[model samples]
Target: MEQDWTAVGDALRARLDELGMTMTDLATKSGVSLTTVRELVHVLNTRRRQPRTLASLSAALGWPGEHLGSVLRGRPTSEPSGFGSLASVHSELQDLRQRVEALERAVRRTD
Candidate 1:
C-alpha cells in the first residue's frame, strides 16, 4: 500500500509540537540532516525516506524504531507480546551504529 506522506508529515509535526521541539532541534537530536527533516515535515515532498533515517528519528524521540518504520512503510504497527525488550535493544543498536558512522566520517576527514 502506498503510504500517505502528508499524513506522515502531519504526525511528525504534531509530535514535534508535543515535544516542544523545532525542526532544527529534531535534526540535531536525531542525527538526521536538517534538509531531510525539513523535507519530511514540509508536506510537499513525497520522497520516501531511508529506514535508518526513520530509525534514528524514532530513537531520538524515545520511540521504538521498528514501529515508526512500519508506519512509514504502510505496514501494520502492531508488535507481538514480549517484543518491547527486543525493540529497546534494536534502538540501542541503531544508536551505536549512528555513533560509529559519525566517528568513521570524522576519521575519514582527518585522513
Candidate 2:
C-alpha cells in the first residue's frame, strides 16, 4: 500500500495548528531547515511518508523520537532511542563533531 504524502502533510499541518505552532516555529524548534519543514508539511498534507520523515516529524513536535515510527515503519527500533527533539540531536551532533575533530588533531600530532 502506497502512503499518500499530501495527506500526511495536511495532517501534520493540522497537528501544528492544534499546538499553536507555525511552520517557522517548527523549523526553529526542530533545528531543521525551513525548506525541509515546508516540504514535510506538504508531504504530510498529502498523507505520504518518506524515509526518516517520522524521525523529523517527531523531533519537530517535541514528541518521542519513535512517535511516528509505527505509522511509517510499522514498528520502532530501540536504537537511537533518545530523539527527544531535533534541538537535542543537533546539539549532540555538534558536540560529537567537535570531539571527533579534537581526536583527529591529537592523532595527527602523535603520528
- Model 1 scores worst on lDDT over the 10 consecutive residues at 82-91
Worst 10 residues of 2 by lDDT: 71-80
Q: Which numbered prediction scores highest in lDDT against the true structure?
A: 1
Q: What lDDT would each prediction earn against the true structure?
A: 0.74, 0.62
Candidate 2 steric clashes: 22
lDDT digits (tens) for residues 19-60 of candidate 1: 656888789988999988898888667776778988887776
Per-candidate alpha-carbon RMSD to the true structure: 7.5, 9.4
Model 2 agreement with the true structure over 54-103: per-residue lDDT tens digits: 67776667555655554444343343455434545564566579779999
Off by over 4 Å in 1: 76-111
Considering every candidate listed, which one attains the maximal TM-score?
A: 1
**TM accuracy, model 2:** 0.49
